[model samples]
Target: MTAREVTKADKAEPGSPEWLKLVTASKIPSILGISRFKSQFALWHEMAGNVPSEPISESRQDDFDYGHAVELAAAEYWRYKNDGWVISRGEVQYTDDALEFGNAATIDGRASRGAWRRIVEIKTARDLEEWGDDGSGEVPADYAAQVIWQQLITGWHEPANIVLWPQYGKPKIYSIEYDAQIAASILTLVREWNASLASGIPPELDDSITTYETVRRLHPEIDGREVQLDAALAHDYLTAVTDDKEITKRLRGLKTRVLDAMGNAQTAVVVDLKIATRSPARGDAIALRSNTKADPATIEGISA
Candidate 1:
């Protein structure tokens, strides 16, 4: 089954309650475990409504607004560069009824040259090395998944393009072709995730920070009660703590030994590899004084 365009009256705004009901393109990478920023467990809780998303900080909100501004500018630049292409800006929403788990996409813009029209996804990056030559279609896996998900929802057989604006270089565009196999796999994963959502189960826990944050939000307050935990779990935790302490002590000794060996040198290198480098001390270290009490006044010469 293919996706259909959403109507204005029915379309929901981004991050709105209605939008949260459907899996979005931006979230596809996380569900597939390809996202660098978010984990599947975290996404599961979000989709299951087990925990609300963390509030965006003002600086983060500013970054988002700046990125959107960049996107608008990039779209306009792309249009100007390609005189023959017809470009339409703003978000276009789509919903796929073919899949049991509802899927949706909000593409950045559309570009049409002659009879070829494709989805346009704009991105901003500080690292230019992550991108490939223009039109090479080599982008970060998470971003590729995002565009592919967009294609899947839009049912666009033509290759989609990602317009990336780097911090220092001119914008580069990568063309991403449709992959039926990957799209099918994504569909399977989404369906399974939807089933988990319906069953009131979440994805298996992970060690990601996002997972920790989600868990914390799941239990915001303590009841001041203790519950007996599994013996093995307690043992494992204690063993890890012991191991960490020992490792930390050993690491400090090793660092001191290395520093002693270096003598006056600052860096330790082995065959072009800089194994260790000491940073110059910035300023006098502040001595910590306990607030509870001050050290007993030092006796000049009469101390016993």
Candidate 2:
């Protein structure tokens, strides 16, 4: 189904199965680094039309955790600001909610003016263990990109603050300033992704290998198996291969061809294709062969 059709039933009414399904589907993708689940939530919020600024407790755990983190951070800000620091709380419109945007993309939490003047996006990081002793307090590039994209969607001026609460220590606040150029570039990329998804075609993979690795690590069951690549892959690939154009092109072509073949096959027949990188004397070649129980004659006829 088209992204539009897939999202048609995504209205955010409390207790609705459609809403619940959207939340559930997003969980796997978000965890698997397949797509930004937050973006999907944001899109759902926009589609649902001005939902009340209350917490949706029945949402996914990861989402709920993020929301709680933001609220706690906001409360902390209130406490600190009340003591003399200038702090403000943005209205929590949809905590881990779904939002649809202009028939293009979906977003996660959609916050606007309520408690604070600007829109707030809350991201949680377990710890800064990855960054050893860089006192500069560097934020991970991926997390930074996420906040910038949210800024582009919400049109917020101030940099979105990332509340980094480690499991072992106190939370560290990281400020993410909005970069117009960067935000614009992200929007452009997202638009292209929307177009491809609408056509039932997956977007070109810029970092297929890295994404494959991430998916494999997160969902062991789906690893080494063929599955539909979604927006999350597109997003990660774009970020992963931002500098390598050649690999990106090849990966995109391979993904498209594979998806197209699968789309045409009969579901009852259960067609399976094994893709492996072969190092031939000439160069690298991808070998595609069926790995199913269907007879050779049937397979040949189907291919023909």
Candidate 3:
């Protein structure tokens, strides 16, 4: 196997771990549809070397590794089909050693049939229902963006996104063509993000929950470190909190009234809609046997 040269995007501080470094592929999602995110580009800036990034959780990493392995197996299965000018399992380079041009992409497979050439991206999905089979062969937006990114970098005229849905009979393959305008716009957005990182000034945060969580994580409350807000800000905050409390009280009252009125009826009819008041039936859990052996270590911990 030929050694892949590391690009500037893949490089990190001499002693820094790989997770802290921003990967080129991670930025592709931001360019999927819009050129904006909840945390502006601050999260991505952190990802791309501006600041440290949170390491992926072990369980999530395990899922990723498993998915990758499945994808690779699928890629290897079709690698032998490049009969003519088609190069199967081609090594796609995002950038040369100088890292002047191109971004990174690992195309699952590349194949050609006569005058046609395509870059194949294999995906393992939990279910096939995510794909549309109404003769449109529609794929989710993020996956579409990724294939388009591959097309942009690999220069593949048409990129094919093959989804392996195990429950389904065969794999669903969607061949996608490039939009020159979209490509140009995405490149511009990438440059904008790069500029934001270089300037050390992040863009405004969005109203996403992830952004809120990230903000909390970045600046947790320090004990006895309270600052008074101005009248206008205080008014807005109090108004929001008070309104939320009133609305929640009203909702709880309505729900309690409905539950009290429900009596023996499992379902309640509100005009034309049916609201279920009954809980779902659950299976009985297994009972522990008294005959089971107990460990002395468990007793010591229980006592503590």
Candidate 4:
């Protein structure tokens, strides 16, 4: 069944095999490719309010393998619990797929008769080297954003723990906290993105969209230049451009101008360009942006 079809069933109901089938199948499209599927999966997991599971694939069974590892880890965790372990393999419903709005909670076991605690999210890596040395693991920024989203949806007040199980090493756990403001912003962005995708239009890339390499390559003068633009800067830029047409045209023009300037020069030249913005505080700011040096004569000609 298609993703839309599979997502039509109620996902919160327990003891319903159809719900399980639907939940499992809805993730098929996301698991088949490595594109932005991972980000989408993270978002879905957060929305569902359950520990994120790997997408099931027949050829590799990575999801099942990781799930089994988590089962072992959970078992190990229970050994420390003063109360007897009340763990079940797959028993909780985190969300209702039929309805767009829902909480993130486990569909599985309880630690005790009166306490229904959710299992922490599990992520498996091939080795310890795969994780960052800081012990936080190399969780993607987007994935962290999703985790926050999950917390908001589930209304869980406590910080969430993410377990990272390396294939050849002992498991490492990272704690993450939810940010309500960030989650709200992300939800707004996701809604806009989904609407654009549904309308068969891809999202446009703006100045904030250009990666470090792309920016350096396109504007050689910016090469080795250290300038940090935080989320606030990016969010302001994105939100300012309400018209897609205007954004596309402006970016295309800017790209053409930068390329033309770079191509004509043979030596490195620093150019001071005026960046126009709608912000009241910074009205039109003129920043001295540098580029590679081209021949002085050639540069003069372009400037002339």
Best by TM-score: 1
Candidate 4 or 3, higher lDDT? 3
lDDT tens readout by residue for model 1, 79-192: 876688877777678887876666678888877777776798899875443554233446889998988888888777788878888766688877788999998898888888
Model 2 ranges off by over 4 Å: 1-70, 77-91, 94-116, 119-121, 131-136, 204-304
Q: RMSD in angstroms, all models? A: 12.2, 19.6, 13.9, 18.3
Across 1-304, the per-residue lDDT of candidate 3 in tens digits comes to 1224345566443215453333354356753324333244446545545445555789878876787666666665555443444545433444323233334666556566776757776666543334642224467666666777666665655656464534335544566668677776766776766665567666667666656666666666588877877999799989999999999999778767776777656555444334433433337532111212234344443421
Per-residue C-alpha lDDT of model 2 across residues 203-240, encoded as one tens digit per residue? 23333443344334334453466657798978887877
Q: Please report the candidate that would top lDDT against the real structure.
A: 1
Error of 2 at 193 (Å): 0.3
Instruction: Name the TM-score of candidate 1.
Output: 0.75
Residue-by-residue lDDT tens digits, candidate 4, 1-304: 1112113254434323333323231232232222233334342332233332334468467666667667666545643543554544443334424334322334223223344343355556542333552345566454455455445444553565556665555666666676777656655654554454346453333233222233343344545667779989778777776667688999778756764555534222345422221111235632223222224345454552
Task: Report the Cα lDDT for residue 233, model 1.
Answer: 93
lDDT scores in order: 0.77, 0.44, 0.55, 0.44
Rank the models by TM-score, top first: 1, 3, 4, 2
Worst window of 10 by summed lDDT in candidate 1: 286-295
Q: By summed lDDT, which 10 consecutive residues of candidate 3 come out lowest? A: 285-294
RMSD of 1: 12.2
